[model samples]
Target: MSSPKVQLRLNGIRKSFPGKEAATQVLDGLTFDIHERDFVSIIGPSGCGKTTVFNIIAGLVDPDDGVMLYRGQEVESLRGRVGYMMQKDLLFPWRTVLDNVLLGLETKGIDPKRALDTAREYLSTFGLSGFENSYPKMLSGGMRQRVALIRTLVLDPDILLLDEPFSALDYQTRLYLEGILMEAVETFHKTVILVTHDIDEAVALSKRVVVLSQRPARVKAVHDIALNEHSPIAARSDPRFSGYFHTLCAELDIQTRKSA
Candidate 1:
């Protein structure tokens, strides 16, 4: 047996934004490695730099210090190598579900027929087959998110950077989407780095949960989730689930108290 390949690495990453009084430091010497086909979740306090880390990984923002490597080579940007889905679905109201999912491939100048076929396949896989012609406004929140996820997946990026993609939906819908997301990851064999505030979600979906400290954020802890089941719902029922949940809660609580 061999260890998984390292797909992405963040080495001593540090960033700061200008504030009214002074520079507000966000990430401070943060470091982590995302292995190929591994699902990793990042969690921290409210104002910690979780999203900033995603921004750096997605090449939307550059860290003030530190190096990022992709497959052992240092890279300045990962613009096309990573697919990002933010909290908002950000779907165009006018485009039909199919068109929305086709947006990424179309932008990349893919052949129309091929792109359409790919979009249709993903739409069907995500259970949006009959809703192809439906507009975003006509769909439920969960369905719209499913479409969003499919749109990202259709691009087939090496890594998926998900920033609270399921936060806005109802709990049941969130759970369902979690299952859908897991399926997508397995079906696509993608490496994922998810930024979430939900501990349970982190525990349920991740192979490892990386906890960050308060801003300027650093790695506080990283726990390898050893649940017997992979399904989010079923993982929760695993005997060790509660222990992991409580331990994560305690980690966050201690950080909160220190900051307070």
Candidate 2:
């Protein structure tokens, strides 16, 4: 049998930003890869440059040194190949829900009527059919995030970079969306790289977890998640789940903190 194809690769990525005194290095020669149709979660300490990695992959920020390859060729930018979603919904207040979701296809020179039709179909699928005419402010936090996701998914990019996209939502909503996200990935065959702080969320949504170190973040470990139950909520009951969670917390220094 043949091995899975590599969808993306980050080689020797180095990045830094101006600090109060001098440049503060965020990523120091970090390297990683994402296989096709994978759901990979990235976990690390705060300020460890996890978002920086997402930015580089999404073409929002350039690294000082590194090579990013989509497929076999070096990618100049991920403008069309990647879709990015952040913690904040960042939806337009003026645009209606359907109009907002159509933003991606519209930018790609797709026909206006066609984009609207496609966006409508997605809205219907995601249970926002009746809310298409509603504005961003009218929707709940969870609803807004769903719209944001639909906007990204409408473009049907090869990969998706989700940066704590569910962090701001309530626990129940977060869990609900995690299941939906998994279903979306499965149905769309999307290769996703998610940056998140929640260990359980990572374990629930990702097939593999990439753990990064402190400042100048580098890969510390990668764990393949093998859950006894398939669903995110059901996976919690799996005896092995807590072990994976504990191992991750240990790596991220979560378990070592002394009591105040």
Candidate 1: regions farther than 4 A off: 254-260
Q: What is the C-alpha lDDT of each candidate?
A: 0.91, 0.89
Model 2 pairs whose backbones collide: none
lDDT of 1 by residue, 1-260 (tens): 79778989899999999999999999999999999888999999998989989898888898899999999999996988789998999999999999999999999999999999999998888788999999999999999999999999999999999999999999999999999899888888998999998999999889999999988999999999999787989999999998889889998984323443
Q: Write the per-residue lDDT of candidate 2 for residues 92-131, one digit (tens) a residue.
A: 8999998899888988999998888899999999999999
TM-score of each: 0.95, 0.95
**What TM-score, to 2 decimals, does candidate 1 have?**
0.95
